[model samples]
Target: MVTSKVKQIHDFGQSIWLDFIDRKIIFSGELKKLIEEDGLRGVTSNPAIFEKAISSSSDYDEDIAQLSKSDKTNEEIFFSIAVEDIKLACDLLAPVYNEEGVVGADGYVSLEVSPFLALDTQATIKQARELWRQVGKENVMIKIPGTESGLIAFETAISEGINVNVTLLFSLDRYKAVAEAYISGLEKRAADGLPVDHISSVASFFLSRIDILVDPFLDQKGLGDLRGQVAIASAKTAYQIYKRMFSTDRWKKLAEKGAVPQRLLWASTSSKDPAFKDTRYIEALIGPDTVNTIPMETLQAFRDHGDPASRLEEDIDGAAGILERIKVAGIDMDAVATQLEEEGIDKFSKPFQQLLDAIERQK
Candidate 1:
């Protein structure tokens, strides 16, 4: 009876959150088993995940059919069902959530605002707040993209005490900006005599996708040896940024008011290429005050044969060197970040519209 590898990860301080969710697991008690057996701490959902769940299965048909009979718009209908699923997930995760006047605790179920709102600051803020109010669950986190406009809404949402999981982050510079926005929001709230305790956030960095975009370029540059290495090195570098940002006098002041530092969460963690180990991302990035939100396949792969360790802070100087060499190779990392951000929005928006179209077919 060896300890489960996924459960063993908790000993090193990294929480394994399921990145995929469908009503099937929630209602079937499979989700609960993951919590109990695998030590799963939280869940994350996106439009693409929901799109696959709803369109590929009959689990959502009755709900969609009933909602269609009403005068509600397709978007309205989708959220109605999405909210119910989120609430269910929140309830399941509530036990692990510590809300005793504490901030930045885990066990949250995240729901994203519309991906289409990523570029519209005001609309992103409006939808984020609306979704926050609609779900009305303390353990539920509303995910906003980390785009330029999304960062504006993120700061505002944090100030308003809405827990946010900032998604689609790519560059180190943008990650720092996201951290600044979180701190600025808490600072504003504390200045206004509002309670800063209990607000939670995680700056999610899309990992494997970084390599997916950069590998071919590396190949052409005769730097194919660096194919799977860049994403891990970038993440290690980002973890260093996290440590520095949260150790400042400014962040310390907020901590005194019970504000918890936003943690760095690894997203898009599943390996896309079969040439890499299934647990390539997870094995390299395990550290405290961090999370790795993995898809079900990766989750199962880890539970079966993954090795758990605290390696995120390893090879610090080497990590920096990897990034520097990539720059010297004439790769514009900033340009790559911008392209990934735009593509990430479209990745979600297309599936979102498809989900809406599927609901329209119900009529």
Candidate 2:
């Protein structure tokens, strides 16, 4: 029997997606079990996760060797391997897709466009189109960063009726921007006589990273107890933006045409600060039309002993107060958001290049 904690999360209307992906999880049937047992609805992947998978496992060695002999560049080889994994995952989750009506179980697998192209709107769009085609799965979402250029690519991709997973959003402003991009894309698709109902998108707002970056500043300024406060506060405010955006006349028009609300996704929920509760992020951000993509350790922790409850809606006024407190503590959140955005790109870019280097070494 699934634990009441896990079941309650689903009952509360939030989707729990596994943030990490590997061949072992996929081929060994572990991923399927998570879907069946834990209500795991989706999978998200990036260069960092893929780097660990390919470098740490022997699963991709033969494919890497064969591709090295071809004229394909290291980046191409990497994407090819990632696409294979995505295709396998998409197939595995197909039943859930069929049963859940596109928004539920077996929702989609996300493969990010090259982090190198995060700033190039045209290139990001080009690469996203190629990735969607290469994966060849109806349930595939091309992950685009929420950078300015990426936002543009996101708009174009949605306009072209391609599914998108907008990643790295750290602020309400950024999340709203991404939502607008999704809506704009849907409007464009609707105008062009495309099926707006089929185009899907999610704005991924990372959690623990916010706390990781802000808590220390809070501590140095005699606000150490504020550790783990910024992330939830930021997310709650972001959901308010989500609620307001989707309720607008513009989005209502698109919704009438079958456009799904670009749901807010909580990413990086694994607790980085050992001082905090293991399930801190997950338990706090529980709300409707949202997703919490937990890493394996966090997932198991929640499954084992988590006291899951419907806490997301319990503290709306308090959540707002938390943000105000942070600002009063002299932490400029707009500056923090800017820093996080820059660091997010660099963080992914390093691992992406590392994956390329690892592939080259294998060759």
Most lDDT-accurate candidate: 1
lDDT on C-alpha atoms for all candidate structures: 0.94, 0.87
Model 2, position 297: C-alpha lDDT score: 90
**lDDT digits (tens) for residues 39-129 of candidate 1:** 9999999999999999999998899889888999999999999999999999999888964543247789999999989999999999999
| Model 1 stretches with alpha carbons more than 4 Å out | 99-104
Q: Which residue pairs come into collision in candidate 1?
A: none
Give the per-residue lDDT of model 2 (tens digit) for 175-283: 8889888888888888988888877778999888888888889989988777788889889888888899999998889889877888889998988888888998998
Alpha carbon deviation, residue 83, candidate 1 (Å): 0.2
What ranges in model 2 sit over 4 Å off? 2-4, 100-106
Measured on C-alpha atoms, candidate 2 has an lDDT of 0.87
Q: What is the TM-score of each candidate against the true structure?
A: 0.98, 0.96
lDDT of 1: 0.94
